[model samples]
Structure formats: structure tokens, C-alpha cells
Target: MERRKVDVAVIGTGTAGMVAYKAARKHTDNLVVIEGERYGTTCARVGCMPSKLLIAAAEVAHQVAGADMFGIHAEHVSIDGKAVMARVRRERDRFVGGVLETVDGFPAEHRLQGMARFIDDHRLMVDEKLEVEAGRIVIATGSRPNVPDFLQVAGDRLLVNDSVFELENLPDSVAVFGPGIIGLELGQALSRLGVRVRMFGVSGNLGGIRDDAIRQYALETFNQEFPLDPSAQVNRVERTDKGVRVTFTDKPKGKSPSEVSEDFDYLLAATGRRANVDHLDIQNTGIELDERGTPIFDHYTLRCSKDHIFIAGDANKDVPLLHEATDEGRIAGDNAGRYPDIRSGMRRAPLSVVFTDPQIAVMGLTLDQVKERCKGYYGVGEVSFEDQGRSRVIGKNRGLLKVYGERGSGLFLGAEMFGPAAEHIGHLLAWAAQKHMTVTEMLDMPFYHPMIEEGVRTALRDLNYKLNIDPQMIDRALECGPGA
Candidate 1:
């Protein structure tokens, strides 16, 4: 076995691992990044970039077909499923190229192209050949799409986001196994592409929004485009001559069929993803794992059981979004390089978004998180897109925005909203929450006329009223001196 020693070793060349390497490089060049697969980050290769490309194509097809609603006689807008998919892949490859180029630029000796397993606290074996001794290690292996055991027999009929994006053509119809963000985004996009789609959610919630109003609106809107049943629980899956069939139990109340036997050209099992830690040989590192088999790491510092070891990204089973992964990678890398006298960073306010039409967004603390943290005394308010002028003018009046605040102090706590450009709205609120801004402080800022951002103004206004706050402070313009 070849023996090597490095100051730091990073496993997995995905988003988290790559960021860890880049951040660690600032401290020392004595580091190596090991890869078990392709080098492109998840955002560039499969998760974000390609999925958005496909969604854009589907959106175009949907818009052209609905042009008649705008008093314009739109002609037949036939969809070229094959061409659309091909274009997405072509563009997606370009994004992946940048990531590959960056990885390739690293010193040849600093990159290890193989799977790595922990041998001990500070040692790893790469590809059953190289034994790497490191002062510290950062594990950022990311995750893989979770599919139940029985569902795998369907073979090619079963699709995950990774395989789904690589398809040369779209299937005629699909039965989505989860109505979460990934499922809803692709499910709606597929429907807009003229694919017959039926979606099954684990529970009543939609796209991770626990806010009752936003979740309900998301369900109602997505249901208008495709069939989505929130009460569905898939129990069995089998292959058939026509396509794949799925059996679901606990049908929704007052539904047509007592049992659901859904048949479609494809079965998308997007329930969620599982951490990719099984192959890491974590037991050798003496790290304690959570009930989910993920390593128990410090939330603030991203440190594992051993001071020199850290876990980040989906492998930790916490925040799996691209941006969160980047932050975590930086934190882990910084600590891994510095070691013993470790420095830690504060966790960012939580922000998650779903890229569907009238997108769903959750910013900072959720309602439940807020209730627990604030003792259920937070003031709440909401606004409907149907009641908003911009949404009405744009002819996309279908969403809801709800904001929460501290009762007396009226501090902006967090929000869950589903509306046009909810991603941007989510960002705006997350920034405010991070700065510990109050409702009056948020309102002091300018809100452009006839825009989706006005929705924030409305929600904040309503929240102030709930707190019985005098509208004079918010309604008045900013001035250096009072009554000047």
C-alpha cells in the first residue's frame, strides 16, 4: 500500500467537499481532495442548473398555450420533448465544465481520484491502495436519492433527479412519489410539458412550508396543473407491460377510489435523499452517529466527535441546499485546518425555497420553530396574491404571504410565503431576521410601486396592525427630525 501524509484530506468532490478544499487552501497547500465519482458540483451537474433549464422549457410551453387567456389567439404550441431535453443537457454540460475546470486546476498531487474510507482518527485508505495520513479530515460526501427497496425492481422506469435530468426524452406520463419541492417542481414542469402527471405527498404539507396558508395555496395551485394527493403513502411498486404501477394507501377523504393503483411511464421516487456516509467507514473514526446514521456534529462549528474531523452538507442530514452547503464547507474547512484551538461561526438564519410557479419560500425560523423559541406569542399576518394589485395585473394572482413577528417588540421573526418571486422575498426576510430588524424598521425601507415586493409591505402592515402598532410610523416617510 502506498503511504502519503497531508495536513488535510477532503472526501467527495461535490459542493461541500470542493468548498472545503478551496477554503482550506487559503490556510495551507498541504491538502488533498478525494473523489469517488464525477467532479462537477451538484448544483452545476444535476440539482439546480439542469433542473431549472428543463423547468424553463416547460414554462415556455405552458405560457404559449395560455396566451389565449390574454385575449391573444395563440396557435398550436406543440412541444418537442426530445429537443427540449437535449437543450437542457447541452446547457447543463456547460455549467458542469466550469466546476470541472476549477477542480482540474488543483495540483495533481492534491487531488485523489478514488473512494476514501477512514482507517482511524487521522488516517484514511483511498481505493484500497493509498493510505493517507492527515492532521485533520473534513467529510462532505453529500447524498444520494433515496428509493425504497421494493421500488428498485422497476429498473429504468424509476427516476431520480440525477437520472431524470440525463434523459434524452420526457416520458408520456409520470407518477411522482413525493410532493416535496423536487417532486412539485418537476411534477408541475412535466405537466406544463404536456406529460400526464400525478403526485403523492406524504402528508398535508406542501414543499416544506409548515405555514397553513402558504401550504394550502401551494397545494391548490399545483393541484390545478396536476393531480396531487397529500394523504397518499406509497406501499408497493411493480413493473407492468404498459409501464410501472404503484400502490398507495391512506387515500384522501372523499376521494373517488379507496385504493390508488397509479400507472405511468415513469415512477419518480423523490421522497428525499439519504446521506452518503455508509462507505466512509465512520466507525473507525470513533464518531457517534445520530438515529438517522448521520454523524453527530456540532451545529455551530461543524465539528464531529474528534476535534480534527468535521461533517458538512447533506451527509450531515441538515441543510442540504447549495448555499448552505457552501457555508458549512467553509466552516468545516476552516476548523479542520486550524484544529485544536478551534474557532466557530454562528449558524445562519435558515432560508429554503422551492422553484415552482408562485414559488414557496421559508425564511429564518419556521412558525413551529418560532412558537417554541418565542413561547407562541409571536404576532402573525398574511396577504393574498388574489388581493394584490401587481399579481392581478400580471394575471398570476394565485398565492399567499404570511409573516411573523414578536408580540410587543414587533421584531421580524420569520415568514413562509408562496407567491411570484417568493425566493427573493425569502431572501429579503432572511436578511432582516439576521440583522434582528423590527417591523417598523423593515417598513422604513423603500418598496417599489407595482412589484411583488409590495406583498412584503402588505404582510408587514398586517402584522403591525395585529400588534396594534400605530400605522403612523410606517405610513410616514423617513425624516431626520420628527415633525420637520
Candidate 2:
């Protein structure tokens, strides 16, 4: 076996691992990145980028199909699944090609194409061939779809998030088994593609956001937008002559509870995701992982027990979003080069988005989280998408945006939006919350007129109304000065 040494060895070339590798490279020329697969991580090839592109294509197809509603008559609107897959593949190659090219530019000895396992606290055995000793190590191996034991994926009857995109043909019917981000986004996209999609999950609807009002609005929107069977816990899935049959247990009374099954061409299991830590052999290292198998680290500095072995991304378990993973990767890279200090304590508020029609974007504390933690320190205000002019112009008058704040201090706790442009607006709220901006400051800020931003203005007005202040105080405060 070949033995090598480097200053930093980054395992996994996914989003988090790539960011850490790039940052660490600036600090030391002797850095090696080990990748288990041929391509980049999930964000680049599977999860975020390709999924969004697929959803965008579906959105356009749906709009063209509905063009008749706007007096634009069309005989027929059809989608070529092969073409869609081609575009998905082409775009994925274009995006990941750049990363691969960059990796090739690094020194020959700095990139390893193999699985890395821990040999000791400071050394790793790669593909049972090369032995690498590093001063610092970063675990950027992302996550994979969590498949329950009751369900078995046989051939192509069932699939997870990663394998679903490579589907050869669109299914006539699909029974989605979870309501997480992957489930909701893919379910909505497939439904728009004319698939008879039924979703089953433990929650009344999709979970994660904190505010009940927003959650309710999202659930209602999903129910209306797609044919979702909420609160359906699938007991098992089995292959049948016709196709696949999913059995449901504990259904509501009067409903068929005895092995009610649906025959579908395909089944998607998006229940949850588990950290990819099983192969790392952490026992060989002094590193400790959390209950969920995520590497345990100091929340402030993102440092694991051995200080030099840092973790980020989904592996850290603090925040799992791609952007959060990248941010944490940068912080970890910076801190790994130096001793931990108070400066590294600065943390940013994490933001997440669920891509459904009238997509959901949430940041900071949900109303329930605030109520549980601060006990009556929170206030909430909501406004409908119908109140926004842009929503009217776009013909999507469903969904709502709700803002939460402290009762006395009026500091922005967080905001949730279930409307057009919610993902974009959620980033603004995340920035404000991270900076501890007051509601007054956010309201006083000027937003363009006749846009989805009007929803933000209206939501702030509602919050001011709850505060017993004039709804027009926003306009008045804007007139005071930019600082208002």
C-alpha cells in the first residue's frame, strides 16, 4: 500500500466537503479530497440543483397546460419525459463538470478516488490501498435517503431521492411514503406532470416549520394544489403482478383499514435522511458522533473532540441546508487553521425552504418554538397572498405569510411564508434575524411596489396592527430616513 501525508484530508466531495476542501486549499497546498462516487455530492447531482430544474420544467409544462384558462387556446400540451430527462442530465453534467475540472487542476496526489475509512486518530485508509496521514480531517460525506425496514426497494418498483431522478418513464401513479422536503417537492412536481400521486406521512402534513398558522396554510395549499392523503402511515409496500401495492395501517375510522393498497407503477420513499457515517469507522478515531450518527461538535466553533477533526454540513447535525453546510464548512476551515477563539462564536441564523407550489421558506424560531422557549414573549401576524398585487397578477392568490416577533422588545424572531417568492423573502428574514433587527427596522425598510414584496409590507402592517400601532406606520417610518 502507498503511504502519503497531507495537511488536510477532506472526505467526500459533496457540497460541504467541497467547500471545506476549497477553503483548506487556500491555507495549505498539501490537501487531499477523497470521493466515493464519480460525480460531485447530492446538491450538485441529485438533491437541490437537478430537483429544482426538474420542478421548473414541470412548472412550465403545467402553465402551458393551463394556458387555456387565460384565453390562450391550445389543442394539446404534452411533455416528452425523455427530453426532460435529457435536459436534467445535460444540466447536471454542465454544473458538476466545472467541479470535476477544478478537482483535476489540483496536484495529482491531492485528490483520491475511493472510499476513506479511519485507520487511527490521524490516519485514513483509502479504498484499502493508500494510507493518508493528515494534520486535520473534515467529514463532508453528506446524507442519503432513509428507507424504512418495512419497505423494500426491489429493482425499480421503489426508489429513493437519488435514484428517482434517473427514472426512465414517468409513472402513471405513485404512492409517496413521506412528507419531508424531498417528498413534498417531488410529489408536487410529479403531480404537475400528470402522475396520480398520493402522499402518506405521520404528520398531518409536511413537517419542519414552527408556526401552526403557516403550517395549516401550507397543508391547505398542498391539499388543494395536489392530491395528498395526509396523515397516512404506510405499513408496508410489496410487489404485485400489476405493479406495486402499498398497504396503509391506522387509517381514520370508516376508511378501509385492512390492507388498503394502491397499485402504482412506482413508489417513492422520502421518509427521512440519515447521515452517511456508517463506513467511516469512527470507533478507530477519538471522534464521537451524536445519537443520529452525526459527528458531535462544539456548536460555536464547529470543532469536534480532537479539535483538528472538524465536521460540517448534514454530518454536523446543526443545520442541514446546502447553504448552511457551505457556511459551516467555511467556518470550520478557518477555525481548523487556527486556535478556537471568541470570534468564531459568531453564528448565523439557519434558513430552509420546501419547494412546493407557493413554496415554504422558514427562518429563526417558529411561533410554537418561541412560545415553548420564551413563554408568551411572541406575537404573530398573518396576511394572505390575495392581499398582494403581484399574486393577483400571477393568478396564484393562495397562501399566506406570517411574521413572528417578541412581544415586548419587538425583535424579529422569524417569519414563515407560504406564497409566491417565499424562498426569496425567507432569506431577507434570515438576515434580519441573524442581525437581531427590530420589527420597526424591517417595516421601515423600503420594498419595491407592485411585487411579491408587497406581501412582506402587508405582513409587517398586520404585525404592527397587532402591536396596537397604526398600519401606515411603515410608510411613516420610511419617510423619516433610511435609518428608520
Single out the weakest 10-residue window by summed lDDT for candidate 2.
475-484
Best-matching candidate per lDDT: 1
Model 2, TM vs. native? 0.90
| C-alpha lDDT (0 to 100) for residue 397 of candidate 2 | 79
For candidate 2, lDDT tens digit of each residue in 1-484? Answer: 8999888888887777878877777777888888887757678777888888789888998888878767888868787877787788789778888877766776777779998999888999999999999888888888888787776743457778888878766778888888778888999898888788888877765756566677777776787665566577676678887678877764444886665767788888888888888889998988876776667788766788888888878876667787778787777766655433312645667678888887888887766676775477557878898756888887777787888766555666778778888788988988887777668878899888778887887887777666533435434433442122
Off by over 4 Å in 2: 205-207, 249-259, 339-346, 468-484
Q: What TM-score would each prediction reach against the true structure?
A: 0.94, 0.90
Query: For each predicted model, how many residue pairs clash, with residues at least 3 apart or on different chains?
Result: 0, 0
* Per-model CA lDDT versus the true structure: 0.85, 0.77
Residue 92 in model 1: shift from native, Å?
Answer: 0.7
* Model 1 lowest lDDT segment of ten: 475-484
Flag regions of model 1 displaced more than 4 Å.
233-235, 248-256, 468-484
Candidate 1 residue lDDT tens string, 225-337: 88798876677788999889888774455875566677899988888899999988888878988888889999889998887899988889998999889999999988887
TM-score of 1: 0.94
